[model samples]
Target: MKSTEPVCQYELKAARDAMEVIQGKWRIPIVISLTYGTKRFGEIHRDIPDISPKMLSQELKALEENKLITRTLHDSMPVTVEYALTPLGMSLRELLDELRNWGKHFRGEIVGK
Candidate 1:
């Protein structure tokens, strides 16, 4: 049985806000990469094959702005930067795992594999 109550605007707006933050082909992938461990710019670019440097830079900025990831700078002979997921970002682990499980199930069902 389903409740007949209409969905509230607050609920819809919250969902939309979540979607807007992660909205982009690269944002999720970028977050996925950071899920493993901290990585430098090149490593992230290589991890997600075919993403141009410019795009990766842009997405990293967005994720950082959203407080999902932290960018750290190391000062050596030359500066190095690394990215790691924030606590907020790590909060998505369970969600990502669910997506992975569902994707595998869907693939098996649809592809008959």
Candidate 2:
């Protein structure tokens, strides 16, 4: 007999987990910034001036924990750390791009400005 489920429970769980990782005010912006290339903490903070250091740190930690990004530390004179998107995170670029196109279409239809 066929189970006839739209999606497996594990697939649903994966979807929910992905959402949780990216579901935050600053998370998407942070991810988008890293999509281009690696960035240092100060660079990210400067790019997002509205986000407090504490909040940005929290989001970076969460993203790192979820394997969406990787943090590398260099043993230079003062020690340097940079963040780059993981393969999983980079996979979101296409999806986000599609969303951006959809948003533009919707805005044009509704706002018509």
Candidate 3:
């Protein structure tokens, strides 16, 4: 794991593909928010501060198109829509957790927190 070398071509392509799918600033946060279970549009916006309605709508559509999350329209009195992670998106949970841990460690090392 400590090899200081470039990744193989296949691994490079795979990492690039993942970066393409989860490229934008809001995508990962959006996915993280959904990890807590399904939530409505407003709830997601509220959970992630500073994301505009338009951007959230656009990202949600992109995530759905990428098959990471599902958008369900519930037939209730007022018609509610909820977003939930598909198995593919849930697959990122461990990776995200690892990233979080690394971020904390890096911050502590660099900032002396």
Candidate 4:
């Protein structure tokens, strides 16, 4: 057997790790919406009405832990929080664009819609 596994295990693991960061029902939408600019919890929720509040919060925390998004707290009355993409997250724009294009093409080819 001439190595049935990946040439580099770390690289394979890294790719899987990256996918996990954005893998979910709401993570990609959350990331795409943030491209418009920083937004508060409610603003994000409004932008993606299909996602429930708890799911959104969970995705936000995952993105934050992955260093993909940053959360800021405002010291005003009642305290408001906002989320923005980190440099790593912003750098994903090109990749995201390509993925979006590919998805459209794939859907069109398959569904003819």
Q: Estimated TM-score per prediction?
A: 0.86, 0.80, 0.90, 0.85
TM-score of 1: 0.86
Better of 2 and 3 by lDDT: 3
Q: List the candidate 2 regions with Cα displacement exceeding 4 Å.
A: 1-15
Report how far residue 83 has shifted in candidate 1, in Å.
0.8
Ranking by lDDT: 3, 4, 1, 2
Name model 1 segments beyond 4 Å from true: 1-5
Clashes found in each candidate (C-alpha, N, C closer than 3 A): 0, 0, 0, 0
Query: What TM-score number comes out for model 2?
Result: 0.80
- Candidate 2 scores a C-alpha RMSD against the true structure in Å of 4.5
Worst 10 residues of 2 by lDDT: 1-10
Inter-residue clash pairs, candidate 4: none
Between prediction 3 and prediction 4, the one with superior lDDT is: 3
In candidate 2, residue 14 scores what lDDT?
A: 93
Q: Write the per-residue lDDT of candidate 2 for residues 8-77, one digit (tens) a residue.
A: 8898999897677779789988998897789999999888899999999999999999888999999998
Error of 4 at 36 (Å): 0.5
Best-fitting candidate, measured by TM-score?
3
List lDDT for all candidates, in order. Answer: 0.91, 0.90, 0.94, 0.91
lDDT of 3 at 40: 98
